[model samples]
Target chain A: DVKVTQSSRYLVKRTGEKVFLECVQDMDHENMFWYRQDPGLGLRLIYFSYDVKMKEKGDIPEGYSVSREKKERFSLILESASTNQTSMYLCASSLTGSIEQFFGPGTRLTVL
Target chain B: SQQGEEDPQALSIQEGENATMNCSYKTSINNLQWYRQNSGRGLVHLILIRSNEREKHSGRLRVTLDTSKKSSSLLITASRAADTASYFCATDRGGYQKVTFGTGTKLQVIP
Candidate 1:
């Protein structure tokens, strides 16, 4: 089975604080993504990486940024956290152009 | 972004009954996938239907796609408590790399 691991299962950060959520995949997939799921809003992509050090912004990438320093790890960074940023964050990895993705346990982040 | 929209936002059914959820997207896609999420946990992939294909099945789950209509449906036969979860349909235009999720359907299978 493909495994994607998120650095934290739950996190609490104060407003204006910086936060980092990490994800690592064992499948060596070329694509990695980060998303924040809000009630009724579903899951909105924050960022995705196609290769090492390569990234692209998704639908809701305004307050977030991502980094892929290596093939297996991708990180999502919140420059300045806000209460509105509280949501369930998910990490996913997949092969290039493949619809089959493997997901990591979500990180429920609360920004106070 | 570009996530499909699921109909009947929520549904409840007795075990052994069938549950169906619909999803509609705005643009053309190379494939559509269904994923199930339990409570606040991670998502598990259920099935994927290519845009060129019309239908597919896995276990008791059946998925049908209407590319011309830009819509799809998922049916769970003889539903069980384990089938209770939020189901989302993701659309990916063939680079297959850019897949977006839909607002999910919350299903509850009452025993």
Candidate 2:
């Protein structure tokens, strides 16, 4: 089974605080992605990594960054949490060049 | 800019009825996929239709794609209360596996 796990289901942060969201997938897939879901706006990709140490910016990568130091783990970093960055964050992984992505449960972050 | 746009931002239906949703994109795609997400949960992949294929089915779910029109539709037959969730359409524009997702359609199935 493809299992994707996130470090937290819910997180609260104060403005200007740095935040780190961790995701680990057991599928050993070559591609990993980070996305944020907002009400009415749906899910927008923040960043993705095709291989270890490789990353690409997605549609909404302004306030976020990502890391893939290992094949099974991916991390999303918020330089400084802001109210506008409060949303449901999701992580996903897929086999090389495959379209079907397995997703993690998600982390709901609240910034105040 | 080229993203899938799902029609009917919200829908309400009774259990055992059929619900259909449409999606339109602005560019050519290698494949189109449908997914369901329960409130506060991750998305569940439902189906995928290739650009060369016109239609595909998975149990109670049916998906149709029109590459010429850059549109697709997902139909759920005999929907149940468990089917109440948000549905999204994603398009793979055929290169490095970058997929763009649509806003989504919120479905409410009253049992």
Candidate 3:
């Protein structure tokens, strides 16, 4: 069984403030992804990392950025948090490509 | 962008009854997978069927894929209360790292 540990299960940040959401996976997966899910809109990808320090933008990456400083850890950063950035953020990792992705519990963020 | 199009966005079934979900997609794929997600939680992998395969089963869950039609279906036999969740179909594109997901079908199993 793979365990994806997210630093926070719930978060609240004020507008214009910088926010960081951290995720770590015990399994050494080559690919990691960040997604924000909204009600009725489904899951929209933010950013993904294929290897250390390597990244790519996904479907919705306008207000977010990511950092993969190490193999087991991936972080999502909101340069300037806005009310629109509030949503359920999910982290997932996989061996590569579209193979089964092991997902984190999720972090519910509320931007004031 | 590639997407897995799912039909019957929502369903309600009685306990002990069977439930079925369908998925359709465009473009070629290497494999198709099913997933389950509870309210406010991350998704759990249910089953995976490759393009070459027509049908596969795991426990009470059955999945079928029709490449000629570019579609697939999932059947949950004798569903229980715990089986109630949002079901999604994901397609593994021929590319190494492009996997797209469907909008999902919300299944409610009434007791």
Off by over 4 Å in 2: none
Tell me how each candidate scores on DockQ against the true complex: 0.77, 0.76, 0.56
Tens-place lDDT per residue, model 2, A31-64, is 9999999887878999999999999999889988
CAPRI class assigned to model 3? medium
Give TM per candidate. Answer: 0.97, 0.98, 0.95
Tell me the tens digit of each residue's lDDT in model 3 across A6-110.
889999999999999999999889889898877666677888888999999988899888999999999999999999999999998988645888889999999
Model 3 over residues B7-67: C-alpha lDDT tens digits? 7899999999999999999988999999999988998899999989999999999999999
Question: What local lDDT does model 3 show for residue B76?
Answer: 97
> DockQ: which is higher, 1 or 3?
1
The window of 10 residues in a row where model 3 chain A has the poorest summed lDDT is: A36-45
Badly placed stretches (over 4 Å) of model 3 are: none
Query: Candidate 1, residues A40-111: lDDT per residue as tens digits?
Result: 999998889899999988888998989999999999999999999999999999987577889999999999
- Deviation of model 2 at B51, angstroms: 0.3
Candidate 1 on B20-81: residue-level lDDT in tens? 99999999888899999999899999999988899998999999999888999999999999
